[model samples]
Target: MRLGPDTLGTLPAEIAQCGYDRAGQAIGVVHFGIGAFHRAHQAWYLDRAMAAGERDWAISALTLRSPTVAEQLGPQDGLYSLTERAGAGERTRVIGAVREVLFARPDAERAIERVAAPECRIVSFTVTEKGYCRAESGGLDLERAQESFYPVLSAALAQRAARGQAGVTLLSCDNLAGNGAVLHGLVREWLAAHSPDTLAWFEANCTSPSTMVDRIVPRTTEADLQALEERLGLEDRGAVFTERFSQWVIEDDFAARRPRWEELGVQMVADVAPYEAAKLRMLNGAHSLLAYCGLRAGHTYVHEAAGDPALRQLAERLMVDEAMPTLDPAPGQDLAAYARDLLTRFADPALRHRLDQIAMDGTQKIPQRWLDTAAWHCARGQAPGAIREAFDAWCWHLADARFVDDPEAKRLVRAASGGGRQTLLDACFGGGAGAPLWPEYAHLRPLFEGRRGGS
Candidate 1:
């Protein structure tokens, strides 16, 4: 039997099922990019909130690309299993927060209607870094904006405005610097280009609060599915695997009334910038470094690479020496301890996070993860040695003919083939030899060349 409303009573006693009454709940959040991360993190938090008696914040999830998620969850009545792994221990729970899943393309009209509903107070996103369709110059690429969620959002907002309805909060849960502000800016730009009349309404009505979400959710495999079946005595296509640790630091600036998420362990703060920067620079930066360097070192999984003495040292230095110095942590924030925790999380063998998964879309990720840190040190006349090495590793990864899955792969590969190290730096960082950090990068030519010769 498949895991659904009908099979809810058949689950094993040890496995926790959704304790809340799903029929009484209403959809208040329309989430974009319904991937594993969203299911395991934000949706999980809302699930807990529901379990604790908050009934009106169920999620209506939409997939921007593939229908895999929608197909997986739709048949299961928007129910799924979340497996949290910690060392040798594991816990399983059925999450009932996602009330429905819609494929944005085929169900475009219904998706818009859902977002335009007055009860929908929040429209969140967990699209990856590249999903924003950002340009190298840091603004919305109008040409690429057509293919992004901006158009759908604009139409929904327009519909709501036409109906004289209230505006919804636009929460960005992506791993980008100032994600909320960035998303708002892009939406404004997109509105200005396509729907000029909606621009003023968006500016006055909607709120995009920055958020910092943390969780290590690996891509689920056949083994995970098999294990879940054995544990639940049913098949759950929407099952997701993640680490035991999960956190959400949301900026307290919603336009309308929201769920009592604070009571559910969410940090509703005035500003998420400090937390955001620490996660992006320290945690994400180290992940990128590990991904590129670890893959080059023939390590497939994050734990394998994090356990390697040489790779671990490089990751540690990247977080503590390079990334940590650039952050302005919030009051009571312990960055050193945070870095230590991140290193330990990266070393969690049970998570089985793959290096290649982290390596995807390097062009979209490196600027926030590494280049910004390098620029910070360059402004201070100090070279960030760890970042430099990681940058070189990224270049090496780009140059490899093993099929990079980056948006700018062709451009990166072309740059990697010509003009030596400067050319590659120019392609990746966008400033060629004239960029402020060019000198620091150029100085690493000897190191890169030596690595080429197996030093």
Candidate 2:
């Protein structure tokens, strides 16, 4: 049956709440960084958990940044829509797993105390790679701009440890190699820096389960809401749309209880390394390549980039030629096939994932995706042409006076290499630059210059 947007848009049978589930149970999980991806992925998994007789998995989604989502879900009785589209067709599901919502901005201390409750057994994060407060070299990045997230997350954990809330698993749902270890270091640094006494308790009690999550969650748009509303025959105050494929791999590090995520397509294994590395290099690394090279060249979405013969060829060459060398073969699965799948998914004509969306926070993401790739090429005595080309293009993107001046841009902005886009090549290529794609792979100029350089 269809429900108007006024009466809380219709949810599929699996996620629909009868009188009791609608009444809401106690909150067992607290999620930081409440964005569309988390709602579409993790909370959706929780909804499945509740439907399968695991009623204690209710989530209290906390927004560590803005009150926007907290405000939207709080008043809507903690219900939202998960809209999935395959081509022109769509499926809408209402999620009832979120029991409560709160913003940390106005009341940071209270927000921590609330989640530190002894019953809140799970503390998960989807704060993206930038949120973990990491350095380009993959440690606790305690720079001027990144201090807030770590200190804030640590403060909350310290409070929890103090309340003897020792049994919670701190799960990180970000895309980074060894994300759990990275966050663990940041949290340890935070506790030592501030609450030394609580450091022992947290160190002894908490578990940061490393995870590898894969999904192409394009930014939500008005069209998503309108299409979903049309399907449900009403206005949806909260609707999140994403592509069909989803994956999660956990390192199985939990000492205390954790969600039964494995029951919902999540892989729990001794080591999530190979799967994570394969995906990161082939999937996310390619995304960064496309964003710098694709978007700079006037491509708006990933599909367009994939469709471009020259760009796609370059993307494939890097993933197979440059990236594949460093990685162990993706066991049981064709690594080439996986790269092809990633290309096809990114090229989804229906998804319309923006290049600009992929392009953001490059200051943080580049060190991991591109710089690391450059290092690999440098070791082989190869020029990082494609990688350097992307870096040069990124420098152009960063070179903008307005963008360069921003606090986040500080790390990326340096004195211009004096030799122009090609010079940063030396610094990045010999290790990050000095690649063949430049001076040799000349086709890069058109890709890097784009219309901005000229018409």
- On lDDT, the candidate that comes out on top is 1
Q: Give me the runs in candidate 1 sitting further than 4 Å from their true place.
A: 417-422, 429-455
> What is the C-alpha lDDT profile of model 2 across 1-455, one tens digit per residue?
22323475244454344233645577778888888889889888888777876757788777876788876676676777776666766666778788777776666666576566777787889987767765544446566324355555666777776667665687888877888887777778767776788888887888887888887778888877776666666566666888888888888988576677788788888777788777777787788778767766778888898888888988887788777776775457578788888877877788788877887876556655665666666666676566655665667666543323323554334423234544443333232443322232232333333223211
Where does candidate 2 stray beyond 4 Å? 1-6, 9-22, 135-152, 399-407, 410-419, 422-455
lDDT (0 to 1) per candidate: 0.86, 0.69
lDDT of 1 by residue, 1-455 (tens): 99999989999888987798897988999999999999999999888888988868999999998999988999999999999999999999999999999987888888888899888999999889888987756788888777768877889999987888888999999999999999999998898888888888888889999999999999999999998898899999999999989889999999898889899888999999999988988999999999988988888999999999999999999999988888888999999999899999999999999889999988778767877787778778787778877877787787773637887777667666655555665543345544332333444343333334011
Cα TM-score of candidate 1: 0.94
As for candidate 1, its clashing pairs are none
Point out the worst 10-residue segment of candidate 2 by lDDT: 446-455
What TM-score does each of the candidates earn? 0.94, 0.84
